[model samples]
Target: MIDAINRKIIAALQQNARISYAELGKKVHLSAPAVAERIRKLESAGIITGYSVKVDLDKLGYPILAMVQCKVYRAKEREFKALLLSYDEVIECINVTGEQAFLVKLAVESLSQLDAILEAFIDLSDTNTMMILSTPVDRALPETFIK
Candidate 1:
């Protein structure tokens, strides 16, 4: 179970993952070695999964953000999953229990790219496309319930 100190460390990491152990120790009021040991323990327990960099998709030449919702027929679940896995544009695919079977997040350069992706999906399964108008807020919520 995470204690108060571990929670502080996790919060700090979430804010700035590149913060050195010495700096984190200063923030959390622990020695550098102690903070290191705590972080190691968190990793061993699977509480701290990994770190990643947040990139600007548009600046990176990915000017399109589309959420493709698919209402796949029950008969083609395996095939659909395999097709999605093969598509590099698919950032994430989630299965939902409502009218839509899966919601896919795709990043691309233009409508032509989206059209190509949609054509592939339409040939494989029934899908509905919804272009993202704007992302007002998109940020990770803290894993504050770890304790």
Candidate 2:
């Protein structure tokens, strides 16, 4: 089980992953080497998977944000899954419970590009697309602690 200090380390990482081990030590009340060792152990145990940078897709010229629900035919699902995986515009895709087999999040430049991407899946799956106007709650990982 994770101790209290490890939880604090995780909280500190969530705030800013770019922080140096020496800087992180100050926040968690530990020495630089101690912090580094803890981080290594966390990674080895798979408690700390990896680090990432949060980016603004809109600022990067992808103005169109869409959530596409795809109800796929089981017989042709292999091709459908592979096709979606190949598209750069399709940023996120996950198997879902309700009416749809997969929920795909897309970031694209225009409606034409979105249409073209969807056309390829038409034969294998029935897709419902919803364009995102504004994201009041942008993408964030599930937070277990904050400190």
Candidate 3:
């Protein structure tokens, strides 16, 4: 179970992942070595998975964000997963319930590219697509829950 001090450490990391151990120690009122040990423990326990750099997909020439809900044939699930994983445009693919089997978020440069991608899967799956207007609430887990 996470204790109060550990919660503080997690909170600090969430705000700024690049913060040095010494800086985090100062925020959480622990020594740098103590903070380092706690972070290592968190990583070992699988609470802290990994760090990633946030990028601007639009600036990188991938302005189009599309969400695809695919009603995939049950037997073809494995093949479909492999196909989705291989696609460079697929940023996230989730196994979902209801009529849809897979929900995928993809980035592309143009409508033609999006059309080509969906057409590739239409032979084996019933797919629906929606364009993302904006990411209004993109965030990590709120620190209050850990506290």
Q: TM-score for every candidate vs. truth?
A: 0.92, 0.91, 0.96
- The predicted structure with the larger lDDT, 2 or 3, is 3
- What tens-digit string does per-residue lDDT give for candidate 3 at 22-112? 9999988999999999999999999999988899999999999999999998788888888897889999998877989789999999999
- Pairs that collide, model 3: none
Model 1 per-residue lDDT tens digits across residues 1-147:
588899999988988899999999999999999999999999999989999898988999998899999987768788889999998889989998887879999999999989998998876578888888788997665656646
Q: Output the number of the lDDT-best candidate.
A: 3
Which 10 consecutive residues of model 2 have the lowest summed lDDT? 138-147
What tens digits encode model 2's per-residue C-alpha lDDT throughout 1-147?
477788888878887899999999998899999999999999998889999998888899998999999999878878988998899998899998887979999999989999998898798889999988887885434345422
Find the candidate with the highest TM-score and give its number: 3
TM-score of 1: 0.92
* Candidate 3 regions with alpha-carbon error over 4 angstroms: none
Q: After superposition, which runs of candidate 1 have C-alpha atoms over 4 Å from their true positions?
A: none
Q: Quick one: ranking by TM-score, best first? A: 3, 1, 2
